[model samples]
Target chain A: MTDKKMDIIRALKRAGNNPISGEELGGILGISRTMVWKYMKALGEEGYVIRSSPGSGHVLVSAPDKLYPSEIMDGLDTSIIGGDIRYFDEVDSTNDVAKKMGSSSDEGTVVIAEMQDSGRGRKGGHWMSPRGGVWMSVILKPNVVPAYAPRFTLMAGVAVAKAIRGLGVEASLKWPNDVLIGDKKVCGILTEMDAECDQINFVIIGIGINVNVLIEELSEDLRSSSTSLSEIKGEELDRIAFVQALLRALEDEYIRSKTSGFDSILEEWRSLSSTIGRDVDVVTPQRIIRGKAVGITENGTLLVETAEGLEEIVAGSCIHG
Target chain B: MTDKKMDIIRALKRAGNNPISGEELGGILGISRTMVWKYMKALGEEGYVIRSSPGSGHVLVSAPDKLYPSEIMDGLDTSIIGGDIRYFDEVDSTNDVAKKMGSSSDEGTVVIAEMQDSGRGRKGGHWMSPRGGVWMSVILKPNVVPAYAPRFTLMAGVAVAKAIRGLGVEASLKWPNDVLIGDKKVCGILTEMDAECDQINFVIIGIGINVNVLIEELSEDLRSSSTSLSEIKGEELDRIAFVQALLRALEDEYIRSKTSGFDSILEEWRSLSSTIGRDVDVVTPQRIIRGKAVGITENGTLLVETAEGLEEIVAGSCIHG
Candidate 1:
């Protein structure tokens, strides 16, 4: 149903400034030219800007900046992750949606939303998810122990950093799962899972990227610490292209972690780490440790050389000192 | 509503062969004599045999072998676990019920069933749960890491073994979570959990004990490896009493694990261990290892001393050699 409309939109997108003829779209979609014309009218209603001249056919001017499945799937190069994408205009949390999904859902299924009402970070901390940000969660059924869950968070952080860096933007990973730009946070990763003692049932890695969000819209307290892509770049980013790259990068890392092991990805993580080699304050639930950030453990815990000794903090809030 | 009937049943059972006057039952229930008689009639319809005489008020002749909430709750002394028991005549699996339960469910909630249509062990291995067995799951939301999950399995094994031993039966715990009577298995535990890398959402400890199941009625292959309480005792055992004791024992161990850490329970597990100091073979998903079961690790993994030196097998099927 939406496939024909999507094919026309994709074909028009590929045509750039050139108009794609109705005959060509009809042949591509295996529909009649009359149907193609009807579909163009439908696309216009769906917020697609298509200019049609008397001599030239339909040319795609612009697409609505919506994270719809059709838009995200247009150029998504991933073979697994995001292949079965569920797009929501607004959701309480993409992680919640993924958690409630049945085991029958595909392993690499992804849930995406334009806005989140109750998005959260690790330990149920609130996450600010505006409409312009990429609020998404990827459902992965990795055959690993629940103890090894933080590895996925580390993997996702590396993927996000890699994708952001690929766009010529400088991005770095903070300890645990935060992506930062020069000591300000731009993205946070929350990993949740269900498992047995020996096996993992599934893991939902919630990734909240403040792409086109306005920094001023956040609470005053967060303004100094939190930053978005649009703020750093002084302009809004193409979220659709960013998401395609993110899903592709995430899928690549996820597959690599499964096949080669997490060490390779961990190496990439260390290279992009902003917390390592810095004096930091790691606050766990029990106590706060002031130390020089040393390195990360194989289990994805932060190893900090404190005044007392070297301490391995499994999960915590890392504050750059 | 059922609590009233349970109170009446408990009163009658306390009276033994002697009949409890209607006045006595009414006083204990805080109800009128007529109400007591009506409740007694209802209990009779639900398979309790009450012999009522004109002068000798009412004497409980026998209770049905049903693991009803009233039956199990009558003498259950647990402060936490089994406080909110959901009993079913049959279910696909008690673990499935607990897994499907919402986070709002109490931390120490219990789900019990008389039989499981598709009972499973670790790695989705089939478990034979007959009508007279105690196929149950206990839900615990411990504030611990997901890696600590296997410790709960070990804790549960010790609890089961201790409870069985309290009944004056010779029961021992095998590595990773199996309770054995001599060389045959009488109980198997499956601990499943939902957690993040750092915090646990909840853990459902599924325990399937062959209470009064007839060994001959089991599948031919299972008959040789499995033993039941009836086969050991040469008569049907009291399931209601056994469940009450098991729940109490489990709650004790669970609380100890939370308050004092799992070391104490680990010590008890080691004491009652049948696998330790025995020539054994442990089969894990990755490989098989034959060694003398030397000791158990703090993480609840089996420590086997092999020709290749010491090995810690986290999860596996243990076969006594």
Candidate 2:
């Protein structure tokens, strides 16, 4: 759909269940009245409930809940980060799609799928992304070195946790990149980058959230360690609203990270961190490091106080003591 | 070509211009005499100067000067670095091909081109890859993190410098990733990595060397700063032999780095470095750091002593002061 139609939808949404005259929409969109009527008719055909009366002009009652390109683009508030979103009903993984698209697509382009057939987590583990889960990847072209790429993952974790917390659940961060609710995993973030000699071409941030997935649908082993938003909130949350909130939060954090330093984001992340100050066993390929998670370095490395001394881990799997 | 054909060619090369009987070749290769004769006839048709005597069998007098897959693999000594090589007569860039092939290609696979129409350097600069230049990229699936990827460029610089110095040229290392003779650059290395989170999928080490390129062929601006081997030595060097030495050095350094650590490579790099102990200005996107190069960190970062104090630079373009 064109941006003009989206602007018209936004104007009607801003009116809030009240009718907006075709002349007003045309004036707002800088188009003719005939063009505005044509866009309204097209939107009506695409499952948007628009009411028109002799006295009242046009009211946008509701929009489709399905994550369609037009539906998601209708009310997006960001200037970037989701300006161009590709929606898929099923995919192998949104990250894979984003990686393929990253070479040609503009920065801040998004790829989202309802279900992933072969979703992946950190360290090559499988992530079960069933229906009702938020499986999405965002392409970011940040002007930074590869050494600083890990900090983007931390920023994303903060954004996701903040969005979840905004829904009245106590969401927290796990070391490296994971979001949890009361010791149960609710979101997993996998960040990937394509870089050459210190210069980064693009970074793909893949976020998988168990929004409304049922407990029985999860794998037997993961059922005990994972929880969904509906399970904690005692009701099914609107996926569209949740995704909008998440994207807004992500855009805010991403802009702040690029403009200001990561000091504020790091502070917020540390406060929401569930791993810091906890005794944990960080498993690397070389050896298992048993230490207390003292703090995080400026580069996003976890500073662990091992028996030998202080050790900074760039990548690892953490198991709490 | 098939590995079998390459193996037969290797056996012929091992004979060193001496004729080996067809029966002897068959016995050595565990193949029939007819098969040996067929392979010899095929190699002769492919620009190989093979002499066949009725009783003495076949002898390899010379091979093509072009960087063919068979010619490169004929007598390669490295165990993994060049076990698989893809050769192209002309390409946009070897790095482009290597990045595409890195996903499925095994570690140590190489992609080489005789001429590159659009070779690249660091910071999106164009590299002059005319004929007689060694334009190649190696695909390495090293078990390392993305932060450690820059060290591979330093290691490649060391390897290329060692290979050039072995030929009696005064080759030395530059800051970050460049090889120089005196004050002019002779080789440029671009290292790229595909990574997600903390795990690295693969790294492509693209090395470009101006072996026999004429100085007049370079662009007007690069002519003053860039020097080729032929320009310095006043004679063209053997391109095939130089590539062989480079691969050997790279394979050795790569193996040692994986087994021991980057400490040894760091030591060797520091010793050959022209930037260390010299006053230089490191230009990053954020700011310029002017200081005396003091040392290098284990992660291959340049340690500079500025007026403020000692500073570690992760990625930058160094200019001699």
**Top-scoring candidate (DockQ):** 1
In order, what lDDT does every prediction score?
Answer: 0.88, 0.88
TM-score of each: 0.86, 0.81
Candidate 2 lDDT, tens digit per residue, A78-156?
A: 8888889998889998988888778689988999988999999986789999998899999999888787778888999
Q: Which 10 successive residues of model 2 chain A have the least lDDT summed?
A: A65-74
Candidate 1 local lDDT, A128-205, one digit each (tens): 888899999999998877777889999999999999998788999999989998889999999988788878888999
For each candidate, give the TM-score of chain B.
0.91, 0.88
Error of 1 at A216 (Å): 3.6
The local lDDT score (0 to 100) that residue B34 gets in candidate 2 is 91
Candidate 1 residue lDDT tens string, B146-218? 8788988898998899888987889999887789999899999999887778888899999999999988878
Task: Give candidate 1's chain B TM-score.
Answer: 0.91
